[model samples]
Target: MKDKIRIGCGAGFSGDRLDPAVVLVKDGKLDYLVLECLAERTIALAQKRKLQNPAWGYDPLLERRIESLLELLLEQKVKLITNMGAANPLSAADKVIEIAKRKNLSVRVAAVVGDDVLAKLDVAALSLETKQPLSSHGKIVSANAYLGADGILEALKTNADIIITGRVADPSLFIAPMLHELGWAENDFDRMGKGTVLGHLLECAGQVTGGYYADPGKKHVPDMVNLGHPFVDVFADGSGLLGKVNGTGGVINLDTAKEQLLYEVVNPHAYYTPDVIADFTSVKLMQQAKDRVRVTGGSGTTKPDTLKVSVGYQAGYLGEGEITYAGGNAVGRAKLAGEIVRERLRHTFNEIKVDLMGLNAVHGNALHSTEPYEVRLRVAAKTPDAALAARVGEEVEALYTNGPGGGGGVRKYVHEMIGIVSCLMDRNLIKPEVIIKSI
Candidate 1:
């Protein structure tokens, strides 16, 4: 077993920059490069696209990212782990193979499947909020369980160069590689907890590296425009160093790491995961250098019996339109324009959100200045019927010459919003399957 392994995070979410991965591969000489690309709703959107085209459900930029980082990844001999395969890891693996073939580079890509439980799950699955069954909502789009490091370890056993998964837990992308490289036992709860803590710290890529922590004068980051990706040099004992790329803008400090540790974490004493229950309450973050933090003291308990499932459903059709009014009497004109549109769509839409964009949109009348120079009249609605939703924008457009004057740069949008509901399920039923394919 290796004494230490260096893992770099390329992309934190679905639309993260591809340049950071390139920078890491070109300079870091890392052992593994993981890209956590899937969010809860991304799979539903991918499923929507898949319904239109059977072959396309993965991340839209998967091919572009792979092509951009292929040469560097090959030269650095860095294994890739990513959840870019949103709703379709197999198709994404095939796409990777195609890219490798086009470039005449030999690569083995693995796809971890079985997270999708839409077919097996009942419509009566209770939502986390109201405890209402999923059937009580609109049409359900997708249901996926958060898979853990099991599939990743299975895939790595096949000696794959890259691993792609659908709906795996964010931290598993990093933890799986660590397990494989360190040859750690599956039941090592303490080490697993430590590894999970490390994974959580780096899962968001830029968050712990000062990218998301910057608050202008309060936490100013140098060269914030070109913020660097983060990498961890972790040992089998669960101790590690957190730092960013050399010569890149961004700081890795105790404050940033601590802030990230508390992100999305409800109970610091018991952080639930598919694999193990990690405890970050006792973990310590110490600054090892100018842009490096040493992490230690993480512990883990037995795994949760149930896995968290994210259910995506069609909430309703959303229609929105906006028009800007400037110069003399801008706020008055904007308010009138908003009222006009609101009045027009009153009968058509079930619920509407009408606002004078700059003046009373976000905080309403709670925090605002009177007599603004310019304001935007924004009208939005949620309707059961797409036609009614489409009409909201049309009604706003009709106000051009009929109701409001000096309304410029009018924009409208109609979309079918996918909403999410969460529930827990028996972990045994949603086992992950990993398969490696050659290119």
Candidate 2:
């Protein structure tokens, strides 16, 4: 078994920068490269795309990413693992094979599947969020279980060059490599927890590398424009050192590591995942060097018997319109425009949100004290009927000519909104399998 393995993160989200991933593959000398690109609603949106076209459900940037890094990854012998498969892992693997063939590179790709649990889902069950029956959510678009690292571990055993998966837990992508390379037992809860800590820290790619920690003068991050992603040197005992590529424009000190550790963590004592219930209360973050942090002291209990399943359904449609106003009481004009749209749609739609962008958009009316020289009037509403939803933007666009005198830069948008809810399913109900394709 290897004493330690080096892993690097590429893209954090679906639309993350492509250049940083290229830099990591070319210079990081990573044994494994993980791209944790799937979000709760991303796969749901990809399902909609798949319904429109069979071959287009995966990540929109998958092709470009594969084309850019495939050659370098092959040259460096770096295996890739990503949830970029989104709604379609099989087709994603096929796409990777096609890219390899086009570039005259021989590579084996593994696609982890069977996360879709819609057919096995008990719709009568209550949602974990609303405590309401799943039937109340209308038409179900997708139901995917949060798979763990077992499927990925199986894929690694096959020596695949790339492993693509659908709806796996974000941290599991990073943990699987540790478990495989370090030869850590699947039931080793302490090691699993430590690996999870490393996975969670690096899962967001640049978040632990100062991308999300930047707050200008307060928490100033250097080279914000050229922020680098992170890498971890995970030891067999589960401790790791987090750092970034040298000469990259980001810091990986204790502050960034600490901030990322608590991110999205509802309870630090019992952070649940597919692999184990990691306890982050005892995680240690010590600055090892200028841009490196030594992370240790994470533990966990047995894996949960139930897995979280994200259910996506047809929520309805969202109609939105924005109009900008400048000079001479722009906030007042924006407020008046928002009020006009609200008044028109209040009776028709149950959920109408009107806001003055510069004045009361984010913090609501509580922070409405300051009036800026320019303000934007945004009116949005959710409705079941597409025609009614279209009327919301139409009314806002009409303000350019009739309601508000100085309204300019009018923008209108109407799209179907996917609603996401969560439910727990038995672990045995999910059957993850890996399919390998090669060029």
TM-scores, each model vs. reference: 0.95, 0.98
For 1-439, candidate 1 gives per-residue lDDT tens digits of 8989999998889999888888888887799999989888999999998888989999999999999988778788999999999999999999999999999999999999999999977888788877999878889999999999999989988989899999998878888877888878889889989999999999998888887899987987888788899999999898899987789888888889988989999888888888899999889888889999999998998999999988889998888888889999898788788788778777776678988887888998887857678888888988877888888788778778966689988788999889988888899898899878896
Per-candidate local distance difference test? 0.88, 0.92
Q: Which runs of model 1 end up more than 4 angstroms from their true locations? A: 369-371
Estimate candidate 2's alpha-carbon lDDT, on a 0 to 1 scale. 0.92
- Displacement of the residue 214 alpha carbon in candidate 1, Å: 2.7
Which prediction has the highest lDDT against the true structure? 2
Which segments of model 2 are wrong by more than 4 Å?
A: none
Clashing pairs in 2: none
Candidate 2, 1-439: lDDT as tens digits: 9999999999889999998998898889799999988999999999999999998899999999999999999999999999999999999999999998899999999999989898999999999999999879879999999999999999999999999999999999988989899989999999999999999999999999999788877887888788889999999999999988888898888888988999999999998999999999999989989888999999999899999999999998998998999999888788888888888888898778888888888998875776889988888888888888888889998997778788999888999999999999999989899999988
